[model samples]
Target: MKSIFFILIFTFSLNIFSQDQVLDITLKTLDGETTNLKEVTEKNSLVVVSLWATWCVPCKNELDAINDVYDDWKEETNVELIAVSVDDSRTVNRVKPLVNGKAWDYTILLDTNNDLKRALNTAIVPYTLILKDGEIVFRHTGYTPGSEDAIYEELKKHL
Candidate 1:
């Protein structure tokens, strides 16, 4: 009986992790247009959702590294990257200028209220979620110098 209970618990835990999905949340684009997270994922076979902030160095580095190879990734895997800025009202204005100055070719969205962040249970900036068929397939938080390669490798798996 004890062994059976443990097996059941383990299976339930695995199921919970495997079934993670993005919640439907409305966010604003840099162009002041409202967009739904579910809708964005629906349009793409694979979508890379990056939660970042203007003040995070690691987040900036991660995005910059991804930017350098974004086109290649897109061509290879048909993946679309959606950068969501979690900067509140004070720093929200900086998002557009920073994205423009860096010449990042990503679909930028503003999450001033962090509704999406809370829904995703993301604790910090530089959180990345790989969505396949509108469902969460992989998730990674924080960043390291060569982490972009790991992300590319994961994308390759879905291709």
Candidate 2:
């Protein structure tokens, strides 16, 4: 009974730690400048973090959809979007070219080591979450057509 009690305590402690670990990750810009995710979130009232990959079609579609109305989003809600590429070493080279070609307006960051993905305990592309004052307020994975509308609604709720 004592051992079981200790195990339960340890599990509860780990859950608390993971809850705060999301924003503490360190990521780099495509230009190789290192920045902490928490610092980035602190600079914005609301931040939308999209964990994507170069090869994921749904990810690209979601970002492209968001980019179309991003300016309005910024103007209305002052929300900032950060697109974090979860590409590994083999396909990481495609990220810069793809971003350039798409001309996306969001801040792009590199997660070459998948540190953020592992930290978030997510295994899928197109994972999106909203952070308010550096704390995660919402999380969603996968995407469908017109899903950006849903995301926008969620942002408004937090604002």
Candidate 3:
């Protein structure tokens, strides 16, 4: 069933170990600056790559949850959260205003072609991958309340 596939593969519990699969992902930031996943990891000890859409309620919720603690998280871990909006061309227009309106401090990027999503092997909104030392350390999707705690805990370990 579709639900089964999502639960099994889309859930955050799934762990991806292959470095080649997640690295070499180059995407344009919302500001039109080109960046690679590994580059961000190099800049920081840890990097959180979140694939989301402006229209996804759960995706919005996850950002909202992190906006509260992100500043402190930065202070402690020097971790950077790159929020990639997977909004297709149709809805991409609103990504900026929505993010600006929400006041989320995470770095925003645009993946209109979904290059990163395809590389990561999951297209579902709200997919999150944590990269440490240029390797994916953890991955999760479809967040529930308090999932941020689990991610923060993992980040703590990597830091």
**Which candidate number would show the highest TM-score if scored against the true structure?**
1
Q: Which stretches of candidate 2 lie over 4 Å from their true place?
A: 1-21
* Candidate 1, 1-159: lDDT as tens digits: 999999889867654654378778999999899999888889998999999999999999999999999999999999999999999999999999999999999999999999988777556789998998888888888999999999999988887
Candidate 3 yields a Cα-based lDDT of 0.83
TM-score ranking from best candidate downward: 1, 2, 3
The TM-score that candidate 3 achieves is 0.84
Please give the distance, in angstroms, between residue 72's alpha carbon in candidate 3 and its true position after superposition: 1.4
Off by over 4 Å in 1: 1-19
Pairs that collide, model 3: 12-140
| Top candidate by lDDT | 1
Give all TM-scores, in the order shown.
0.87, 0.87, 0.84
lDDT of 2 by residue, 55-110 (tens): 99999999999999999999989999999999999998999999999999999998
Whole-model Cα lDDT of every candidate shown, in order: 0.90, 0.90, 0.83
**Candidate 2 vs candidate 3: which has greater lDDT?**
2
Rank candidates, lDDT, best first.
1, 2, 3
lDDT of 2 at 98: 99
Relative to the unseen true structure, what is the C-alpha lDDT of residue 144 in candidate 2, on a scale of 0 to 100?
Answer: 98
